[model samples]
Target: MASSSSSTKTDPSAQGQAATQQRLTEAWVRLAKQLTSSKDYQDIASLVAKTDVLALKNEKLERELQDALTAETRNLNAIQEVKNENMAMEDACRQKESQVEAAQMKESQAQSQLQKAQEEVAVLKQELDSNASKITETVNSKLEKEVQIRRLTEEMEKMAESFRQTEADLKKTNQANMGQLKMAVDATTEELNTLKALATPLKPQADKRIPSLEAIEHDV
Candidate 1:
């Protein structure tokens, strides 16, 4: 009876060790996900069909990786767009610089033409002034010639009036001497024949004065 009672007491210790082993098995199965429970075994078809926890978690990870790849692609595209805009702006600046160079060349040509035109105007003005001075000198010479002609004509007319007055005084003195000579000739009529013979010498000198007007005008 003592050995049998001792075995019964030892059986309670064995039961306690068995209970601890059962809890360790359950904790290991829960941590490592072993398909141990009969209910877990039966639920496999339902879990796989509904996309159980493992597959759902893998799908979420894959989705996050794909979104990260898409964001990287967008950043690269923005950098390329900025590079293209900078190239366009540089091309526009080159075209503006070319246009400014062309404008400067045209301005230089205009300035040269203006300087040539100014030189031509100055030459023309000098020629005009020279011609005006020549014309003034010619007019002054013509005026002096006209004044000299008027003075010469007045002197000629005064000399002709002095000659006319001298000729009229000589004609009156000759007529008075002829009247005294005729009265003396009548008082000596008896001696007139002999006196007339002496007067015959004066007859040739008187006949010389009675020359024709045509002969007198020809002598003058």
Candidate 2:
């Protein structure tokens, strides 16, 4: 009976030690799992926030580059337009210079023609003055010749009237003395015949000296 009572006491002590070791190991495992899960969640949150900030910075840089390219295209077009306008202006200036030269040539030709016309007019005036002077001299010579001709005509008329009176008186005296002086009357007849012969020649000489009124009018 003593041996059976000792074995029962030892079994009770071994059972109590094994139960305390199992409880301590389960508590340690629960603490280690909670610590590892919290560390993984913190790392994921930090990486997502950094990616959003980088995307916003990239979009701003792209907009600025497009604005600069559009401005450069507009400036190139404006420079080309200015160059075309300058070329047109140069062509117009050359055309104007050519027109001015043609006008000056026409003016010079007109001036030369005017000077020639003036010289011709001066020559004509001199010829007209010379003709007028000659006409005046001819008129003075004609007047002097007319005065001399009139004086000669009046002298010849007076001489003819005196000869007619003398012939009438001689004829009356011959008729009264014819009976008493027959010989003398015959002698007087012969002398009268001779005088008639002389008078006939004198008539032709008088006709040659006188000019007709018609001939003088025609010469004037």
Candidate 3:
């Protein structure tokens, strides 16, 4: 009897709990249907779709921005490289200019030295020419002296031959006239003394000696 009494009490409470659960389920179903049919829900759905499109556009923009930044970085690097190359080229140009200047200076010095050498050579040539002229003049003077000596010698030889012939003629005429022979002998002696005076300067060079006045007179 106690068990039957406890069972009858739990059945009414169970029925009440089941009826409350059914009511809560019906309220949830009604709220869900209202939310699906509302304009706000459709607007939210549209907003979600637009947000997705905006996100995709933002992503594409970010990618394009990254590409642009990369390109800018590359351009900046290229510019720096070009600047460095320009600086190197400028340095090289300056070095070349300095080298050219140095070479030009050396060339100028060489030219100056060459000019000095040429001037020295010209002076030396002038000296050599002057010396050669002086030598030629001295040689010509020596030749003229030799010729004069030879002429003097020949004249002396001719005079000596004339004196010998005159002596021979005087010898032949000595028997014809003694007084005329004495006068001729005196005249021949005077002429021979004059010739001896004239030939005194050439005595060192003459191969033949003039006959002495005493010897000529003795021969006469």
Candidate 4:
């Protein structure tokens, strides 16, 4: 019985040992499966990190594109400004040309007026010359008439002086000849009266003309 009981106890202990070994093998398999799952999780995390890096690069490229667009817009605005300045300059040049043309027209008009004035002056000068010649001719004719009148008046005064001298000589001779003095005095009186009447007609000529040489000598 003791042998049988000891063999029974040994067999039960061996069965228990076998059962523990089987349990150990199951736990090891479960641990290996967990390890594989951890490997998969790590792979997924790495893939996510790569995706994030790609996204960051894409954002940086977009920023660069925006900056390029802004720079192009600024350059376009600058070009437009330059175009506006050029157009303004062209307009100013056209205006200056118009002003210069107007000034030239004014100068031409002034020159035309000056030429007309010169022609008018020439015509006036010719008219003045004709008038001056007429005036000179009239003055010369008047002077010649005055000179002729003066010469005639001088001859008349000389004739009156000769008659007076003849009368004086006859009076002196009559005084010297007392015997024939009556007849001589009668004839001399008649001649003296005739000479006086002849000299009396020069009153109008005396008022209208200059004195003769005889008249001046008599007055002196």
lDDT score at residue 82, model 3, on the 0-100 scale: 100
Candidate 1 has its poorest 10 consecutive residues by lDDT at: 204-213
Candidate 1 has which clashing residue pairs, if any?
none
Best by lDDT: 3
Error of 2 at 199 (Å): 33
1-220 per-residue lDDT for model 2 (tens digits): 9888987675766777777777677666666566446766456656666666666766776676677677777777777777777777777777877777787788778888887777777777777778777766655544443443334445433433332333344456564643333343334434444544444433322222322223322433
- In order of appearance, the predictions have TM-scores of 0.39, 0.37, 0.57, 0.46
Backbone clash total for model 4 is 0
Per-model CA lDDT versus the true structure: 0.57, 0.54, 0.75, 0.66
Instruction: Give stretches of model 1 more than 4 Å off.
Output: 1-72, 145-220
Error of 4 at 90 (Å): 2.5
lDDT agreement of model 4 with the native: 0.66
Sorted on TM-score, highest at the top, how do the candidates line up?
3, 4, 1, 2
lDDT measured at residue 178 in model 3 versus the true structure, 0 to 100 = 42
Q: How close is candidate 4 to the true structure, as a TM-score?
A: 0.46
What lDDT tens digits, residue by residue, belong to model 4 across residues 1-220?
9888887665778889999999999999998778657977578778888889988988988898889889889989999999999899999999999999999999999999999999999999999999899878866655655555555546544654554465456556654543343344445445544544454443223423333334533653
